[model samples]
Target: MRVVSRLSRVPLPALAVASLVLMTVALTLVFYVAPNDADQGFSQRIFYFHVSIAFTAYACFAAGAWKALRHLWKRDPGADLESYVAVHQGVIFGTLVLLTGSIWAKISWGHWWLWGEDELVLFLVLFLFYCAYFMLRFSVDPGPQRANFSAVYALFGVVLIPVSFLAIRIAKSFVHPEVFTLHGPNFGGWILVTYCVAQAALLLLAYTLYRVELTGKRLDARIRELRFA
Candidate 1:
């Protein structure tokens, strides 16, 4: 029971501090330590963080969906909250992907945007879809009904990831026949170190944010209980 209770809660401020440290280390390494790839030059460096972040975001959403499944399937009381926190983090990183992808597109193709980039396009659709998840969450009153709907919708979002990727790939064929391939910069010892630091930092930062947001929500719930009591 003690272990369960501890598992149910997280130390938010400490996690936040650790996340900050990791991010700082990562950025420093990315700029100073990592070497540019010979083939892709400077732009190739972006892939180390960009693609990693994208994959991380996907992992988070998938995690949320799994938790949601547990919540619905096993009736785990903690599952819904855990799922919500994970989804929230996923959306934040997903936004980062769009921003970074746009920048990368400009750097690579001399355009601020390109729909032919399957990853970028796929993220845009996902961002919109998940944004609606929050909307649907708030619009409906809080109860089992809300939880049920959110869980089911989260499941849908997970399915949409691959479907959206396929859609973008197919759309790109007619939309932009010329496929612009992207290759990351050639990195040396320092650059490689920096990218690893950055990736770790980003992961930590995501977890920190998740913990903080979850804590705030839990406090709010507690306060509501007190007031109602």
Candidate 2:
């Protein structure tokens, strides 16, 4: 309880500053310290940022689902709005995943888009589904029903994550005869450290953005209340 209270009271500016510093350090490590892949050469550097963004997108969706569950089950105030904001962030990062992955694919295979890439295809499906979530949310009046509906939809996305991963695994046997491996058996040392740093940077960046968005939403609501009062 004390830890939670302290965390809640921490200034957003301080948090943002910390995140910026950490991300800067991580990016430095990625570009300067990480060794070039012996196989893919310089192009392999893209994997650090691309994979990190994908994982962050997954984290955002999971957070949104958890917030949605809180809204539905615990009736936590502001949980619905928080959930929506998290999902919005997820979509933004997911779009980045598509763009970065496409660039990486083109670099590796001389094609911008590959029809047989299971991970890419699965991400596309999830992206489309979550995009519709916003449309569905705004189509209804803002109230308990809207909250309930959005919560249910967000929950469905959680279930879809594992199912989609499983489907991708199954597709590898047929659609993709050759397995795609990002890291080699020799992946370690500075390469591992740099990858971990990059991953942390992305997660921190995502959380920082989420906090900023949530703060904006709260401020908007407060302004509306003041205007009405």
Candidate 3:
């Protein structure tokens, strides 16, 4: 059996420093080591971070849902807060995805926003849907009821993800009569390494940000409690 107490604790500052170093190295690899594609050229370099951010956003949402489950199922004390923070991070990354995706679209196509872009449209829908979560959360009084509502809403958001993707796929069959195509570059050795590094760096960055935000929130709550006491 594995010994749970055998694990050593790593400080948040150390994690933050490590994340920063990894990010720097990953960025260096992205700019210096990865080759420009013959098809998309230098603009394709954006794919490293753009796609990575999108994946990270998905992960954040999944994590939020898991925390929400904990809040509802186990009645975990801090699970609601953790779930909110994860959703918050997901929204932040989702916004980045929209911005970077627009840039990529412009670079690939001659336009900034394409109405026929299935992925873009789906992301926009999800972005708006999750943005409403903040409104819903703040509209209610803070208590167990709020926690239950938030948990249920977060679960809905996760379910919406795959459903939205499917809806977009179905819509694409008839939506765009003339399809605009942007192909990803073939992944060679260095390119694959750079992508993996970039992905790891972004995930680490997201986790560090989540930890920082959660810490700030906990501190705020403690201060409020002390003042009231």
RMSD of 1: 3.0
Question: Local error of candidate 3 at 93, Å?
Answer: 0.4
Model 3 Cα lDDT, one tens digit per residue, 81-152: 999999999999999999998998898887888867766777798899899999999999999988899899
4-37: candidate 1 lDDT, tens digit per residue: 3573465667767777888777777766666767
Flag regions of model 2 displaced more than 4 Å.
1-7, 178-185
**What are the per-model C-alpha RMSD values against the true structure?**
3.0, 2.0, 2.5
Worst 10 residues of 3 by lDDT: 1-10
Candidate 3: the clashing residue pairs are none
Model 2 TM-score relative to the real fold: 0.92
Off by over 4 Å in 1: 1-10, 184-192
47-97: candidate 2 lDDT, tens digit per residue: 888888999999999989999999999999999998999999999999999
Candidate 3: which stretches are off by over 4 Å? Answer: 1-9
lDDT of 2: 0.87
